[model samples]
Target: AFILGFALKDILANFFSGLVLLIDTPFSFGDVVALSDGSRAVIKKIGLRVTTMYLIDSHSEIYIPNANFQGENIINLSRPTSHYYYTISIPIKGDVDPARAISLMEKVVLAHPDTMGELEGKLEAIDNYYGHSGSGVKQKLKREVGRMRLLAEQDVTRMLLKIEMSLKQLSEF
Candidate 1:
């Protein structure tokens, strides 16, 4: 009984520590965090001495020691409800009006099938100082486009990729 109690105490301590780390730490389950080497991952589990995450590009799972996580910069995409903001740049030559290009890009982004009904969208152009020199116009956009009620991370990536391709095509035109 004494040995069992000792083991149980250690287990309970670890579990509570895991829970506390989950709350106090910057990253949480399902957050896409960028590691030191620019490797991105979506956290899957927060354990006492380790954290489990899936790499974004390769779909590979990784276990990171919690001790190493201290002071590490992590991007938490899950805490704010899985919404993401991205900028799309479109280069326009002297012939094309910058305002017109901005408007067109906004239309394309807002009209995209993946972006249309999924989330509220905001599209706008960033100011460029040069005003010429083959300068590109940047559209600052934000969306909560991924479906949260169903589908897993892979499905979300596929949807995002589709949206990205559509945006690229629009920019090319």
Candidate 2:
């Protein structure tokens, strides 16, 4: 009995932790999270006793015990929206015009296909700069904007449906 208890203690703890995580759902599969160890990873799967994650920097899979995962300080980068703020610092010559440099940098970043910025302004800026260079940045930005809009509309529709169902139940009572 002592041997069995010793062997099953961790397993039972992990199993219960997994159950709590599944119910509370702080993060889900495919969500990006920053671990307490300062590593960023994407959650691949949640299992009975462990969670599988793909580390972004190492490009490798890591399995963490549910109990440990539950105890750690994990930042869910994908929650409240999948958008996270990033910052960069650049050094420029003192002789350069600061305003011009800042403007140029902003335009360059806004012109990137993957960046999130005002759609119309980005399209106009891309058109002015690329001017049919055949880089396809404008088209890609349009497609991405369309996809985001579609996802937002779907979420609104889902919420409306839930509200309608709740109202129906209230009326029945």
Candidate 3:
């Protein structure tokens, strides 16, 4: 019985931590959050066992265990209303419900050529990753491509940051 209790210690701790997370509501779905690992992604889903983060830059989803949250700090990038006013300016169909609107937006964004290309690159890299069946030249090219994509993403993110700063300045004035 003592052994069983010890064996279940971490699991119970994590489960309870998950409950605390739910109660606290520190972050919500679609809010971009940063983890201890320096990984920043949009919070997609918060489950009892795990929190899902969707990385738009890489077009990938990362599942983080709730226990990790208890051990580390999380930064919510979507907090405070006056500074960052993010809104979707798209027009929705008259008959579309909230769920349908969300689904449509997701589908439309994911279907964009640039998004699709990035997504494919991400998929290819993940699939071949360290387990490449091709020659060194092909592998080198693949990695180079991935690097280029990351650099491009970083540039875009930086540009967006600059734009936001400018907007903030304008709003202040």
Best candidate per TM-score, number?
2
Candidate 1 per-residue lDDT, tens place, 1-173, comes to 99999878755665655555654657544567788878889888777767899998888998866656655777664444435567756567989987888766665554432332333231211122112333334312212222231134345446556766786799999
Pick by lDDT: 2 or 3, better one: 2
Measured on C-alpha atoms, candidate 1 has an lDDT of 0.56
Model 3 scores a C-alpha lDDT of 0.64
Q: Candidate 3: deviation at residue 171, Å?
A: 47
**For each candidate, what is the lDDT?**
0.56, 0.73, 0.64
In model 2, where do residues sit more than 4 Å from their true spots?
Answer: 81-173
lDDT of 2 by residue, 1-173 (tens): 99999999999999988766765678766668999999999988878799999999999999999999767999987664435667798889999999998887777666544455655666655545432334565776764554454354345446556766786799999
| TM-scores of all candidate predictions against the true structure | 0.37, 0.49, 0.44
* Model 2 score (lDDT): 0.73
lDDT of 1 at 15: 62
> Once model 2 is optimally superposed onto the true structure by TM-score, how far is the C-alpha of residue 112 displaced, in angstroms?
18
Question: What shift in Å separates residue 98 of candidate 1 from its native position after superposition?
Answer: 31
- List model 3 lDDT by residue over 1-173, tens digit each: 99999998878877877666765668765567777778789987777778888986788998877888866887887554445544668776788798977754555443322232355444444434422323466765555654554455555446556766776799998
Q: How close is candidate 3 to the true structure, as a TM-score?
A: 0.44
In candidate 1, clashing pairs total 0
Alpha-carbon shift of residue 139 in model 2 (angstroms):
8.9
Q: Candidate 3: RMSD over Cα atoms?
A: 18.8
